[model samples]
Target: TNLEKRELVELSTRGLSRKEKLIVILYYLEELTMKEIGLVLDLSESRVCQIHHRILFRLKETLERMREDLLG
Candidate 1:
């Protein structure tokens, strides 16, 4: 398929710890705002943004590696 669904599934399965995974799911899949995530997690909005950024960057690297594996 051209959509590349497996890429996300592989990253979700292998790359993230429980908390980081939860954060990503809540933000992306659930479409929650950063402020809402902070409220749910009992953190500041800025803290939530920082965590989200860190998690996203880590996932980006993981997915890039997977893409390299697929390509090479």
Candidate 2:
């Protein structure tokens, strides 16, 4: 679980867009709610939700590929 989280942080910071990175940092590291993030970013709450979902999906896919490579 920690490894996944670490991978998430590493991959997200490097691979995501600027807004996506800010969203991740505000949500995870700074512990902000989607509504709060939306306010800070001047986006709608739903948009923030979408970005968060997309970010997690990308992170998961990357981590899975890394795991498979390590195993193989």
- Scored by Cα lDDT, where does model 2 land? 0.88
Which 10 consecutive positions of candidate 2 have the poorest summed lDDT? 2-11
How do the residues 9-46 of candidate 2 rate in per-residue lDDT, one tens digit apiece? 76668878999999988898778999999999999999
Candidate 1 Cα deviation (angstroms), residue 17: 2.6
TM-score of each: 0.69, 0.83
* RMSD list, candidates in order: 4.0, 3.5
Q: Which prediction has the highest lDDT against the true structure? A: 2
Compared with the true structure, all predictions reach lDDT values of: 0.75, 0.88
lDDT by residue (tens digit), candidate 1, 1-72: 423544664456465676667677677667799899888888898998988788768878877998999999
Question: Cα lDDT for residue 69, model 1?
Answer: 100
